[model samples]
Target: MEYPTIEQLHTKLINKEITVADLVAEYVDRAKASDLNAFREIFADTDIAAQVAVAEAMFQQGTATVLTGMPIALKDNILFGGHVVSGSSKMLEHYTASYDATVVAKMKEAGAVIIGRTNMDEFAMGSSTENSAYGPTKNPHDTSKVPGGSSGGSAAAVAAGLCVAAFGSDTGGSIRQPAAFTGIVGLLPTYGSVSRHGLMAMGSSLDVIGPMTHTVGDAKIFYDAFKGKDSYDGTSQEQSIAVSLKKKLAMPKFDKGGIDPEVLSNFEMIVEGLKKEGFTIDEIELPHFADALAVYYILMPAEVSSNLARLDGIRYGDRAESVSINDVYGDTRGALFGPETRRRILVGTYVLSHGYYDAYYNKAVALRATIRKELEQALETYDAILTPTTPTPAFGIGEKVNDPVSMYLSDLFTVPANIAHHPALSVPSGKSAAGLPVGVQFIGARFGEETLFALGKIVEDIR
Candidate 1:
């Protein structure tokens, strides 16, 4: 049985053309076949069976929701009750979540089956999935190349058709970059659009949970279900109630300056295709966009260092039994954290160190504020800012492992969205010369996801 999209599968369920059990079984089999090292653990058959039964019941009662019976992969950082929620780190490998994250509960209510936990960069630190304790998830398009990380597994699972869609967290382009590499659509909602109650803290101020799917329409379906206010998360805000996709259709066009020529050409073709279908286009610019990456690195590592400090062995997480408390903390962290994790911790610690705080961390914060202001001003003139998801396609494994700075640069085109707390999506633009996927991103203002989705759909139709 070939993989059917979420829309097709949902239509079949509504029409009684396929049973929930049969659909799940087919996806489970495909997941087993590809494996791809995408998942750290697949849900037990009993779990899937129970969920399918619920979906079937919902259908029978004419109470089906937007995602009824759809199988969806989750990044290990997002907690699901009674499931191991290791953030791809050895420290919490045996930790099982005792409660469902608010997002997980929302997904279940919408009728999505929690398929399995996908692998990721350990503690969501690395740019490549190689840092995962379970090993790197191979890209479905080219096994030798990376799937991009720390949301690599989530992207790979969706691209490989193991699941119609998946959830991934982005602190700094983890969702969008991988989606670009895999030829899928990935969204990063506004900073507080989706509740973060159940997601493990990497960089608390920056982490966001979003959907990755085969199409913009599918992403919007999942987004609508999980976004909005939640009592469990104080940071979550009510969505802009008056906003509609209709308003987004009137957005002006934008030029692709400072982007790769090939990427620009592909984007033009997408624009042309959309214009033929009655969509509008205009040229706009976001000044200070080029400095987004520098600001991100400065802010993210500082936040990461602070958040990860809670993982000291004596605290709530995994601990090492040997030596004194200090030794225990050192040994446990040294043993549990991947090299990338340790590097960030060190960089973060230095940035926040007594005398350097004003020079490093504080400076970075000032830059962050400036960048946010620049983005806000840009959005006043343009509905969305567009760019290629990554400067280049996926590269081979070990190609960037030794050079941390080079790996960080891979997210050059993606960091600005995170910096501004704006919504962004990576939609498939086309395949590269090597037959690898390429993604073009659409960025919008804070709480401007409807605009991103509206424009994303236009691109989706063209692609």
Candidate 2:
């Protein structure tokens, strides 16, 4: 039950070999029957029928695009008008969207069939989907293991063939890490390249919407459709940058002590394969690279604390009944927010508190700029930066849940790109000895997604 790529489905739809309704129905049935819990809700039949009708008309009218008739899944945090977008939390469990997220609106205009919203970490916190209020999403390759967090459900849905492709927001490796765990392709577009008008903000500066799919080609098609500036989003940029493949990649020096032996071995094989393809690999020095995780932890939570303040019962989400205003705020948050979400909020609040702001938050902000400069300088010499997407393959579901520090370390390799506001692509490199998949990541310069696509395609062919 391998799901076809967007282009493959487009060919079928154009030739009339398969109607959009039939294609969407097949995926809807799979989503309904799957035990992975990848989706929070499979849209009602009437809702899907309406989308199918629009897709059919696009084909009949000869205005169909590459994504027309493709069944796509959205992360639960993304708003879709008239549908419940819970952000995988009880707070917004019954909150229906009043309008579409910019990305959703763009997809609708492209004639992509919206299957349903997939599960995620509560308010996009935690490194495992275990934080999801609805329970965890299992890895398709091994049910005992996790699919990786934040975007775990989106990754699992694609890997399990429940949808043609799915969209996930990458805030500190959410999309790429999950794609690695689930054996799929995930792209973290350059910040500001894709509009974030309606996306639920986790770390506003670090978040970027990207495509998770079986191939880099499919990701490109999906990205091209939804990327552009929007008046609704001031961060959205209109950068006119050139894309060129220098055939040169940068590898930073780092300790492999904590990384899995098999992951390291697989990454070496990928490097060797690329060398044979005439690509040059250079081991370079990035002095501030080691501090990326620390800086990300400080900056991200500060933003999370500020952004989530709106979720206090009154403005949005479910309210807790209490007499005093303070009681209502405290009780509602304490009762509805997951442990991981609450932990971040507390940490964020402490860092931003008056006495500690300069010591923790401000210092982190300065270090973040230093780290970004190091990456940018490195990119100027090399076309892209390379690393294993995650230090280890997918761990057991409850393996790191209780150990917060260990869980945060899972994002070590993938967080640098987000911290630097750069685009990154995670491609399946090979499988580990235990038969779990591992991915190799490519971090390109801002607006250099073309460079990533070019290199990713080569990796696909050689690997």
Candidate 3:
């Protein structure tokens, strides 16, 4: 009854030790037990049964891929044609995607099975999953604590062993922060490395899709399956440069070892373990990192305001039945949006207003350029930058929910990578004194996924 990873499950299928139907049934049961409020919707048994049938046929024909019949959870924002794509908001609760996202399409081509949609922050705006319309997803480590967000459900599902792996979007650390809280590996690819075609826009330039799994190797496998150029996404670049750069970069040295007392000790232990394995550890500082959260809030909300402008109820979402068009637009948005969404929308509007555009929005854009330049310079000397994924582990479910600023600060460490357009990964380093998981982040230059995978492997091995 043990849950196997994607790789292990593939081997089991090949050896006939477990059938696809049996594997699917095991996950279904685990999901049912933990429930965890992780899934907003679990796929119907009939749908899973049909997928297992195809997997069984593929196995018999010796055509199964590594992901054949593998169950994967999805953050609700990513479209999966015919499935609801609510982005964890009440605004589009009944809306279904007419087509699959580029990442989803690739997952299907690799023969992965979509188990269900997981919960998240409304429109991917908050750091805690509490902003979800359904409810916050609880941390598997401690049910009273949050799992992190807006990709909290994806991380929680993986940590709770509900699925082999899950797909999560990262814009200001949605995926990495949650993975840290839940004791798993979360990968955020270099911006534009993965196609953003069907993902609901939060901050368009900052969002990137990545994988969350229990191990680094699984992260690599999933990233390989979906990364590369996609015609539908003009931003996706060819993988040739990324592949070549990965081969050239040296693995990072785990120096500058101090972290929080508990996190510091664990990080030191991991470094020593890696040193014995012959990997060099180096200490480097990224000064602009301190200003990342401020920069992120200013830039992300400005973009959110613009991207969400299309949702005025006149476009694709639910419309208010009102006598006037103005009332229809105003009432629908006011009714559907959560506090965080409204806050960002207001901030966005303020920054973009005629009198303030040059002072606020323009200033933030200039700071973004500086941050990006600083990160690029740092990567020239260090293969990757290392840090704690979060300032602390998962807190109480509603602990910081009402305090928007405090919630935004939770993403402080992870947001710098997004602002810099660099790839980052969060791997479980150890546990906090409270027994909650502690994660360490590895950030690399553009197209630096290979470095992340290499460093991630080294860290995970030591941990």
Clash pairs (backbone) in predicted model 3 = 253-280, 253-281, 254-281
Cα lDDT tens digits for candidate 2, 268-372: 999999999888999988888878998889889999999999888898879999889999999999999989889999999999999999999999989989989
Per candidate, the number of residue pairs that clash is 6, 0, 3
Q: TM-score of model 1 relative to the true fold? A: 0.93
Per-residue error (Å), model 1, residue 212: 0.5
| Candidate order by decreasing lDDT | 2, 3, 1
Residue lDDT tens for model 3, 361-398: 88888888888998788777666777778877887988
TM-scores, all candidates, are: 0.93, 0.99, 0.94
Regions of model 1 farther than 4 Å from truth: 1-3, 241-261, 271-287
Model 1 poorest ten-residue lDDT run? 246-255
Give the lowest summed-lDDT range of ten residues in model 2.
238-247
Which candidate do you rate higher for TM-score, 2 or 3?
2
Better of 1 and 3 by TM-score: 3
Candidate 1 has an lDDT of 0.84
Order candidates by TM-score, high to low. 2, 3, 1
